[model samples]
Target: MSIARPDLPRRLAAEALGTAVLVATVVGSGIMADRLTEDVALALLGNTIPTGAILVVLIMVLGPISGAHFNPAVTAVFVARRELAAADGLAYAAAQVLGGLAGTLVAHLMFEHAPFALSPTVRTGAAQWLAEAVATFTLVAVILGGLRFRPEAVPMLVGLTITAAYWFTASTSFANPAVAIARSVTDTFSGIRPVDLPGFIVAELVGAFLALGLMGWLLAPRKPTTVPVATPAE
Candidate 1:
């Protein structure tokens, strides 16, 4: 089956727009949750659901355009797999980062907060890094596995995986570097400290590479072996 590959400009626009909406959903939900409740757990729940739902919507709407790679780590994996050109992948990453920042600004405007503020949320340490690695590994694995087996279900698979990871991981599964960087400018429930960004981004990249390596082999088609037929009374 032939898939329609849009021009580079349109693909980049889709990526940027999709990522913008995704981060806006994340940041806006987090701010709203923080204000609506004193319980941290409840606020987290509020943030997780909207983020997941928006991922589903965004991927469904934009996947056909740019493969909906809102995360730089994911884009890198595709480039490594030879599915996307290096230049286009770089462009996608740039758009995603800019879109993420724009999303943060939009969320802040909606809540009447300052345009940009450094986050003081201290999220660091070995445990946090390990959690990020695991979260990103699982996220990439889910994407690859879904594409391998059920191309139609990738959106739901990603959304559900992220929703679950939000609760399971220590750093709340800031699995996407672009989103993590954008969140650093917000002092809200979903924000991470700028100082800790390196660890998370490195871990995410490591995890993505690991998943690509493992899934590349695991999902490959196995050659069928022919059994030698036994001669009947020969």
Candidate 2:
């Protein structure tokens, strides 16, 4: 079954709207979770469940419209694979960042906080950077592997992978550059220090491209070639 392809404008809108809702869920839930509990583990669990569930819903709803690439890393993969044009990929990235910022603001307003404030929560160091790399690599790998064999399962797979990554990775798997940047603008539960962003973004890029290259090799089609036959002598 073929999915309906939206034009650039509509696709961009879907990307923006989807990303906005995604970041809103992450930030809003993080805030609510923190307020509802004192235990960090419990708070994280509260933050994880809704984010995963919402990811599934968002991807299913918007995948047909915009491919549901809420992350620049994901967009970069598609662009590298030639599944998306360079210009369109740039547009998608910009929309994602803007939407993420807007979502952070929305979350702040919901919690009766200031519109924007730089986060002081520092998330850096080699361990965190490695975790981000592994997180992003796993995300892209899941996406590509699922799409190749089980396109229908991509949403759930991605959602579940992220939920799992949250606990397994030290950085809590902020695998999205846009999300990382936006979260830096908030002092809430989900925020990251802006100073720490460079490492995360660089790690994410490395991981994304690694996944692309690995998956490309793994999924490459085997072409059938004709072997020339020698004519029989009369």
Candidate 3:
């Protein structure tokens, strides 16, 4: 039997695959960075910039096909916007989380044979949680702003947002739940303790909700001015 387009299952698959590729690259590059900490500057610029660029391109390329919501928080925002159904959002989130686990596991294989370290050097604490909150807020803000005001500038703006967050956010911008889950598998520089993932993810969801609400206020339509049409000689 032939299938109709925009099918939920098909769209969800796209979300999963896109998220898998993104998280895989993220964790992979981060592993390389962690392993190459001897030169932190070189590692971050080389590994992270490319990852950000890839995300921008992939989202631009795949966003229309699947809404480009590689992050659960992003999906949640779409739900808030009523652009996606809550059931679909839940499925997308589940797919992304599973995809993240798979990608990180692959990175682990490339990094070492020893049982993957359950520890990450970034260390978890109040400071880190606060950083995550800030990072998440920033990410949600830019993403929603672009979606509301300038869908045309999507991938580019998102790329800039992530790169800036990486450069500035203390948590190294775990602005994505999927990326966080993937990081855990590597036990590398990018890894976050499994114990700490929940707090950050929760913070991110909250940030997304806040951003979704603000967008209503920020992008509300301006009152239309009446432009009377001049009557020409009949």
Candidate 1 local lDDT, 1-234, one digit each (tens)? 997789999999998898889999999999999999999999999999999999999999999988999999999999999999999999999999999999999999999999999999999999999999999999999999999889999999999999999999998898999999999999887888999999999999999999999999999899999999998895
User: Model 3 over residues 133-171: C-alpha lDDT tens digits?
Assistant: 777777778877787779898788888888877878778
* Model 2 C-alpha lDDT per residue in residues 17-116, reported as the tens digit of each score: 9889999999999999999999999999999998899999999999989999999999999999899999999999999999999999999999999999
Ranking by lDDT: 2, 1, 3
Instruction: Please list the residue runs of candidate 2 whose C-alpha ends up more than 4 Å from where it truly belongs after superposition.
Output: 1-4, 223-234
Write down the TM-score of every candidate: 0.97, 0.94, 0.86
User: Cα deviation of 190 in candidate 3 (Å)?
Assistant: 0.5
Cα error, residue 179 of model 3, in Å, equals: 1.7
Candidate 3's TM-score: 0.86
Q: Which candidate gets the maximum TM-score versus the true structure?
A: 1
Candidate 1 lands at a TM-score of 0.97
User: Which pairs of residues clash in candidate 2, taking residues 3 or more apart in a chain or in different chains?
Assistant: none
The local lDDT score (0 to 100) that residue 72 gets in candidate 2 is 98
Stretches of model 1 off by over 4 angstroms after superposition: 1-3, 231-234
Error of 3 at 199 (Å): 1.6
